[model samples]
Target: MSLKAWAAKHYARRVVQSDARWMAQPHQTQEAVFKKLIRQAKNTAFGKDHDFASIKSPQDFRERVPVRDYEQLRNYVERIVAGEEDVLWPGRPKYFAKTSGTTSGSKFIPITSISMKEQVRASRRALLHYIHESGNTEFVNGKMIFLQGSPVLEKKGGIYYGRLSGISAHYLPAYLQTNRLPSWETNCIEDWETKVDAVVEETIRADMRVIAGIPSWVQMYFERLQSAGSKRVGDLFPNFSLFVYGGVNYEPYRAKFESLIGRSVDSVELFPASEGFFAFQNQQDDPGLLLLLDAGIYYEFIPADQFFDDNPPRLGLEEVVLGKDYALILSTNAGLWGYNIGDTVRFVSKDPYKVVVSGRIKHFISAFGEHVIAKEVEQAIQEGIQAFPARVNEFTVSPQTAPEEGELPYHEWLIEFDQEPEDLKGFAAEMDKSMQEQNSYYKDLIEGKILQPLKITTIQAGGFDAFMKSIGKLGGQNKVKRLANDRSTADPLSAFKTT
Candidate 1:
């Protein structure tokens, strides 16, 4: 280990680790409430899709609609370019979320008014759940912190739709207008530097109570909160009760956030996007049961096994199997009528139709049946280092063929350790062991000698940052992407950048 790195580690251990605060309430299991919630979602969303005629079962609806992916939505977006109001949302949209694109440059997703209302309703339900989880009600007393994309109502230079899909500035909550740090919309820049700076200034100034936004953005906000430590929760906003987040998994991030902030903050999860606010993590135990906003979009699940298969099976709400994985499809108040949002999830156990987020359907490497989902990868890393302690800032895994002929696809991991590993090879093997434990498919593949050996590479601090910069994605919103799933090696740099 470098002397400098070792020194930094000891200092951090004393300051951050020793004083870390973790506050969690046992997740609540409100089966009856959640079942009523899902039923409401069915009636509101499906009711409209069937022309206000009540659809009794998830099976009845599934027979008529076919399963689809994000590509199908992109085609609808193209039609929107042709000046067709018949986009996903029914009436005029609030605006698109303008999410950073994966395949192409950027996608201008449409968010109709009904969709926006449905989405907002989901947010409200999430808030109620947060209150239930935290066992507090301070939100009514203080400013709620909403860390969101601040794109405005300005028209796109080109004919095509830009960030503001169909929404206007009038949609922002009235309380936030005067409360916003930067009074003008001009401060909203696509650049990370200006955006983070402006956002940091706002959090400091507002001393926001109920913090909410994308998990990645919230991570950046917490970093700023750690740096700007003078503002105490009580001093800044006495009523501060919840720290709501969504858009990505929070498991790998939870420990770091606790250490940096030096306090235990409660959180709520929302399922908001350009499409609509469809669900909310209203129950603590039900991290993924998503309380469907009965007022917004109609929700359905397609069996995960049917994905990318010749004959896909679309399951109605009733036909959904408990303790199984499924991909989500939605029909909402927004013009998006029966659209699939390209997200996959699993049912942990259900009475109230509760489930845990398994992982994104597309975001994994299981071609030869290794079956490594995003959550499994995160959990394996956590399990591998339970002995004593080992700090990991970030890690990524890519499936690839060994750098030789006749080689099968192996798991390659690039991790930034807080300190050097005592036995790099052992750590990788230990991680593999953990992988085999959590996922049976991977265990079988490994035992069968089909999947290649697990490979590990150490990196200096800020290795991930350097990689993000190379891809022109600096600061917030840049996520860890699994670049390869098979023998394909289109861009090696896409996996992880090195010195």
Candidate 2:
């Protein structure tokens, strides 16, 4: 091994040991984070307004602060944008991560210096843990690329603002900076197509290893690489061993990715957002992501079923039960208190606190009272693909409440396939059967004649990409909704539908 690789492995050992120590005391670590956050933000505008000074326990904090989404918390965020100090956190944030919000058009999530450090630390720990367990640090000597947004930022009110990925680009550790791919000028290109072309030209001949990004965007990059070089990704970059990804589940994209690469590659799944670095995959063999309890954020869970209740109970880390879905809430040192991020997760393990993101609270179908979630649909499709060999590139599920003349209402699945099954109708039937087995409500609706069996609408190759491009969200952490309660996304997809 090279000197650098040796040093990285040595550091990895220490990081893994340290993580084990804190993870053993999940509740205590969370309590420390909670107390620190409350004490530090006591004098802030939001803290003062919520009476944080008198808050003594988790219940007291919960009673004082209501769970709020981005729109509900905009008043305080607007103050911060207007250059107000101590409005949310202890002082003005170092940067604002700009993201597209559902109800609100754009959101500016504060990234305090402390929160920024925690993000970097958690990311580092995840990587070190991988190295420590696998004893593979040879990739450290080669190029590593994070297929990300532009590193460019817009400065306003003395704070830099950009997409979370772009902001993170500015903070690459000194060791990895030299090995990172895509020239600075190439990264600055505003248009995603132009940027990908530039990236392909720049990194085509480099010794690339360890690619990281959301699966969809990475798929685009891989396609570009394949088209430009006429070689499988594995052949083109033989050193590429680790594929790090987050933002969406990778199972649906796994077959397509393996086809593109011509082989299976080890991967690490992360649970990160502009709000905080929440969790990372600690074991390569495990699907569950290890939640970061000691990482400057206090977590709360509301039962997914009870989330719509007027006063859903906010359960602490210790109170969460295995296999039950919960809407994740966060109170961070970045000054977001009791913030509802909309994503729902299920506890897979409690021994060291690991979770699997189940779905989104708002992104589900209940038009016929079936209440089908993203996880169920994803699993159904995966099982279908497994039973009948096929490779899916992209897909989404939306209720088709109105059909022509004599047709009954049904769930419409719009899928873009890299390799379509020989018996498409049979594939759809298998998927429908899987969904019925998983969700009793969906099954009841189908049996009662309230809804027909799900139908598959094939999207032409590149149709999903075209749709996203048309919406100006083609790249940089943008994701097509896996489940839509309405036709907002489905209507636009009509143009891309294959006969």
Candidate 3:
């Protein structure tokens, strides 16, 4: 066997042995892990302020440390940025992962040495589990390319700041780096258009066996490769077999990606954020990702219907019920205490807990009390696309509440299509019908004439791309919000209208 293949098999065997005990009794494992974290950080400033010494259990921990958003935790993070010791975690954070904010320009999330190690460990476990499950070591034997952000981190206040992907690239083990494609210089190019060209030039001829990135960016790279005289991705890299993706739902882009590659490729989805590496797809047969219970993060769930309530009940791992949508809350070794990361998820399994990301808390559309979410919209679009002879490149939706005096409010859809439908009006009607069937509130609104049918506006081929680039959020983990509560996102998209 090849050296890389042999190493992969050995790693997979070790992961299986290590993971068996935890999977057998996940509840006990999670409880013990949570207690260990509490004891470790009880002396920190945040812990002291919240009376962590008095906390005895999950109930006590919740009562002591109230759930907080980024804005609510800004003060503590700022103190850490000013070089305070033991402000949140034991020592100063190693780096600050910068993500786009709603009101704030950018959010700087702390990353400690312990949290960094956990991130690396969780990622490695995910790959090892995949290898053990599939019995595929050829991927590890060949080159793997991860299309990440610029690795040249920017320093601020004695701490480095960059995209989470960029920060993660810095932590890749030396052994794996030897077989990874795309040189450091190519990865450090800030401009995405330039960076993609450099990546293609450097790795097109390499024996690429695995590729990882956000679906949209990776699709863009595949298109670039196809344009360079390659009929399909497999034509350029015959051994390419695994595709790892996260940051957005892959369903909408699945067909497009498969079409680009000229065949189906095994894929693994991950639920990672700037806050922490949460979960990853562990089994090939199951769609849900296995929750990292023993990772340095303690998890809590609040029902989505009650998330905005004045006193939403928090549920621990033992309290969660399968198939219910809940907004995820975290208390991590990174020093975040009951932090609400705004992502919603649904539990799919109990024994070895598994979950599927439902949507984002802020990305819902409930202006008229329809309570529509990203999942609903995505499903509606998927159904609607079936009646058409085209493919959706990208799309976003918003409520049009500012109708004329006699008219009712309605939903507006802005879409950029790679191929146009033969009958535009039929396609729009199909989408509206699908949505009405899925949401009782929406159906009621239509029956009562409180809202008009959804309006569809087609944009030029590269309209969404142009908008993202205009806002300096064109590439690498950045995605357009699929649904907006207001016209803030949809209004700007109209500027790129094709007709």
* lDDT for each residue of candidate 3 in 446-477, tens digit (9 for 90 to 100): 88998999988899988888899988888888
Q: 1-499 in candidate 1: lDDT tens per residue? A: 5443344344444432221221011112222322333344443333344433444444554554455555656766665555555334333344555667667757667655555565554554455445444545545445555554444554332232333312423455564465333344423566765676666666565646666665555666666665665653344454555677766667666656555555667766655556666455655655665535244445667776667788777655556776677787776554454567766667654444555666677777876766577777877777665642466666677776545687766787777665545776777777888888888888888788888667776656666656666667665444666334753322334454445
Give the whole-model CA lDDT for all candidates, comma-separated.
0.57, 0.92, 0.88
State the TM-score for model 2: 0.99
Listed in order, each prediction's TM-score against the native is 0.76, 0.99, 0.96
Model 1, stretches more than 4 Å misplaced?
1-64, 73-76, 85-94, 100-105, 154-172, 175-187, 224-241, 404-409, 418-426, 475-478, 482-499
| 1 against 2, candidate with superior lDDT | 2
Question: What's the lDDT for residue 112 in model 2?
Answer: 94
Q: Order of all candidates by lDDT, from best down to worst?
A: 2, 3, 1
Cα error, residue 224 of model 3, in Å, equals 1.3
Q: How many angstroms is residue 183 displaced in model 2 relative to the true structure, after the best TM-score fit?
A: 0.9
Write candidate 2's Cα lDDT for 350-421 as tens digits.
Answer: 988999999999999999888788889999999889988899989999999889879899999999999999
Rate residue 453 of model 1 by lDDT: 65
